[model samples]
Target: MTTLFFDLDGTVSNNFQGISRCLNFALEQLGLRQLTDLEVLPFVGPPFRESLPRAFPGIDTEAALKLYRERYATSGWLENSLYDGMAHAISTLHSQGFAIALCTSKPRVFAERIIEHFDLAPYFKGVHGPELDGKFDRKTELLAHLVEHYKVAPENALMIGDRDKDVEAALHVGAHSLGVLWGFGSRKELLEAGAKHIVDRPDELVHTIASIA
Candidate 1:
């Protein structure tokens, strides 16, 4: 059976609106000017501090990190909702014998909530997410830990995500990568990062994976 690790935010959830709202809210509270959607959208995949600096240039990294977490935990994170057709795709993959799991940058506590909220618990064998600290900050490190934890060989595993981070993560661990265009990222970005394949929609995902194998 093929093992698949999926990123949570853009890939499984259509919660970008909530994320944007919360980010701006945090900025507002910090007395900083609010960011436009396009500006905030880039924050969706990268670390909060990295995004915040771009949004609030020359801002203190420590304070920015603190406020980012505070806002997300208090409001932004909970506003998330799973994307349409995700449940069906997950169910179909499970029934078809794929080993699916979540490999995300979001913290584990909220990751668990998102999974349970969507009633997607059964579809995933495990959930691995990067810590808020720098320890597991990169996708490469997170993917490596998940691979070791699950005891799945790199060749038998695939990482599915919406951004270059996901593709980069898979490649770092010698796993295949599947990038999705339906999410926040563009095909140009994924292709540039050397994604093995790309899926335009949820239903097409299964076929894409099979063809890759």
Candidate 2:
């Protein structure tokens, strides 16, 4: 079975709600306006340092990041939940002998905490995120690290996620990406980002991988 690298946040955890809330909260604290759901989506998949400046352009970058992280780490990220059937989908893939890895831009401490909190640590072989000083921005760079760390062959690796970033990351690693429509990003965005396949449900990913395999 091929190794599957999945994105967290908007992909599996539906954690964009927390991120959206935190971004809005941070903007509010900065005396700015809250973004609409459509407006907030572009911010979901990428790192905060990158997304924040885009969402709240005039705000103090440092303070905005600080507040966003503080709020999100405290409760915003946790406020989110998983997509239905995600656990089952993961279990089925695992039972079928697929190796699962999490490649996300969330902070390491918070990523670990979220996985543990969600009781999902056992399903994955590895989980990775950003380091201190918050330097990771591009999906291509993160994907390269994941590919090396997982020792994944591009042909045997698939990235499953809900955003364009996930697709970009997969492409960067030379892995095929299957975009899930139920989470954060729109179909157009996914396609524009070069996602060739789309799965409407979690279990559909099984077929997606099988077809690729």
**Candidate-wise lDDT, in order:** 0.82, 0.81
How far residue 181's Cα lies from its native spot in candidate 2, in Å, is: 0.1
lDDT of 1 by residue, 11-86 (tens): 9987687778877776777788888888877888877756667667787777766766677776777788777777
Give per-residue CA lDDT, model 2, range 157-191, as digits (tens). Answer: 88888888889888877889889889878899899
Model 2 scores what on Cα lDDT? 0.81
Cα error, candidate 1, residue 145 (Å): 1.1
**Clashes found in each candidate (C-alpha, N, C closer than 3 A):** 0, 0
lDDT of 1: 0.82
lDDT of 1 at 201: 87
Off by over 4 Å in 1: none
